[model samples]
Every structure is written in C-alpha cells, then in structure tokens.
Target: MREQFPLQQEVTFELARDVGIRHPQVSGSFQVMSSNFLVNSFDPALPKFVLQAKYAKDLSDPRTVEKLELEQRYWEHKNVPWFLVTEKEISRTASQNIE
Candidate 1:
C-alpha cells in the first residue's frame, strides 16, 4: 500500500452572494481535492490553466505522455484550461527559485 501524507492545515472557500431580503446564496465552493493539494481560484489577470504533474523516471515512456493527454482532453470537455508538467520539472524550478 502507498504511504499517506500527514495533514498540516485546512482552509475553506465559498462563492456566495446576497439576495434581496434574504440570506446569502452560495453559488459554489472549493476544497482540497483527495486531501493531496489545496484548491484556489485562478488569478483573473492571468490566462486560465490547469497543471497536471506526475513522477516517473522514464521520460520516453508513452504512459506518462498519454496520461497528460487524457487529462487535457477531460478538462477541455469541461471547458477548463490545462497544462501538463512533471515531477522533475517541479523540482528543478523550485531549486532554481530558492534564494
């Protein structure tokens, strides 16, 4: 079985609006998906996108590339924007950005 990570914190977000002479109506909400990551609103100033990351040593393998393509198609059908990434890319970027 795969090991699980410990929970460090929790946050909540609500998209709501008030109606005339009534309580606030919630249009939507966001929460941590599968307890692995936090969800946040996309910056309106930037282009809409979703980043899908995976850890794999074989960069030439079709599986890794296919997974990203599948995710891209799924999100596209839902009208959500997406981009593909990998674990190595994330680590490299983090290391470079560290002061």
Candidate 2:
C-alpha cells in the first residue's frame, strides 16, 4: 500500500447569504477535490479557499473512512474546517451525540 494518494477536486461552494456570490445551490460538491494542493496566497479580504474532498463511494470501506478522518484531522490541525457536501440528504443530517 502507498502512503500518499492521488489529489482530487472536491468542493461544493454555498452562498454566503451575507453576500450574494458564486453559484447558488451548488450540488455534488466537496470542500476540497481530488488532485489538489493547499496554496495559501491571496488577498486578506478575499483569501484563498483551500479545498479537500473525497468520494462517497470510498466511505463504504471502513479503511477509506479512517483515511478520510485522518485527513480531516490534518486540516483541523492547520486551522481549517474541512466541510463536506453530498447529494445524499440523509448524510447531510447532523448526527445526534445525545450526550
């Protein structure tokens, strides 16, 4: 098995509502994508958006899900919130911790 995997385009942008911008009601999106790099270079007001996304089909495998989690933690450590957007409405629903 390889430690590094291919990069991807995985991002679905949502309307800010605070300001009208980009496409509205974007679909089949990911905060990030396959085969992408995290580049930090841009205006402060209009900072660059670093995207990171994986495919839903991968979730079927427990190993893939674990790998995704690892990636999520990596982004979080860098102070970036890795958001996921899926067409599956059920997946969109928040999980109940009930704690």
Candidate 3:
C-alpha cells in the first residue's frame, strides 16, 4: 500500500501486479486478488498502510496486536517503517482457486 486514493472502491493486488508488469525488468506474471470486504483509506494522509482486520479476522486479536506493536516499536527504534501483511487472505484465496 502507498498513497491510497480514498475515493477508490478497491486497492488490489491486480493494481500492484499491473505495476510490476509495466516495468521492463520486473516480474509481471504475479497472481493478484482483492479482499472481499473492506478497503479503507485510513487517516487519508498516511496512505502507505491498509488495515484489513475484517478480511482476516485474527489481525484484531489482542495477542496479534501486542506482537505487531512490539515489532513496530522495534522497527521504529531502528528507523524502519516496515509492513506485516496478512498471509491468510492469500492462502485462503489460493485454496479457493484449487477447489
């Protein structure tokens, strides 16, 4: 996620893979999909992050939150703004495709 358009309905992997494909030297044949639920515009200013708790429920867990917070603090201490994206959504999607 980067600089989200709050006006858009979805910010999807289709968009990212399209971007990846547009670059001559980049890998273009990536699989892309969208969350079946929310696509938020969080804060409108900081668009680099997209919160998908509803799409993958466990993200809202207290333990997961604590772990994410701890990891975030650790990264921030070292001046890194990294992401911890969900794998379940993609995994479930792949499984669905197989079915």
Candidate 4:
C-alpha cells in the first residue's frame, strides 16, 4: 500500500537548537522506489529528505558553511538524505511550475 506524506516547509526541530540552525527550508518523506530487495527492505518510517535553501552568495560565508555542516551531520546520523539548494541551482521553469 502507498501512503502520502505532506511536505513540511520552514520547519524547525529540536536538533536545530543543538546545531545552531534556525530552521530548514523544507523537509518531507517519500516512498522509495526500488526493484532490489535490500533497497526496499527498510522500515516504512525510515526514509526522509531535507532541503536547505540559501542564496548563492551566502555559500561563501564561514558561519553559513559551519551551520550547514552541522545540519548535514545531524541528518546523516539519522540516515536521511539532506540537500543544499542555492539560488544558482534553481530553475526558473521549476519555480514557476511550483508556484
């Protein structure tokens, strides 16, 4: 059976306090699609995704980098996929569609 999970935006977690992150831009879970038995064998609640959005210019800041690293480690420890999205990487077409 398939279940739907709502996308959470601008969410803060308790771990954010420890990691010095004010909040993450987006986070959610989705079903994993795989034909391999091992890939699909995990508990249903385990897979999740995190997205942190920043301006391209902010990526060079030391504080930003440090906070991002801490956030990455927090997600890594929990075995979730974490991604950093900068303005440069965003496509105008995608943004329009999302709107």
Identify the leading candidate in terms of TM-score. Answer: 4
Error of 4 at 39 (Å): 19
Worst 10 contiguous positions by lDDT, candidate 1: 11-20
Q: Tens digit of lDDT per residue, candidate 2, span 1-99?
A: 112333322221222222232322237443341213454546675343344444667668765554455455445544654555333433433423322
Summed over model 2, clashes come to 15
Write down the TM-score of every candidate: 0.41, 0.38, 0.32, 0.50
- Superposed model 1: Cα runs more than 4 Å off: 1-39, 45-48, 55-57, 87-93, 96-99
Candidate achieving higher lDDT, 2 or 4: 4
Regarding lDDT, does 1 or 2 come out ahead? Answer: 2
- For model 1, residues 1-99, the per-residue Cα lDDT tens digits are 111212211211111111111111236543222112222455775334455545556557765454344444444644556554566666766867864
Window of ten residues with lowest summed lDDT in model 2: 10-19
Error of 1 at 11 (Å): 29
Candidates in order have lDDT scores of 0.39, 0.41, 0.39, 0.54
Q: State the RMSD for candidate 2.
A: 16.1
Q: Which tens-of-lDDT digit does each residue in 1-99 have in candidate 3?
A: 323222121333333244332211226653222222223345656433333233357777765554345434433443434455555545776868868
| Stretch of 10 with least lDDT, candidate 3 | 4-13
lDDT of 2 at 94: 48
True-vs-predicted CA distance for residue 42, candidate 3, Å: 28
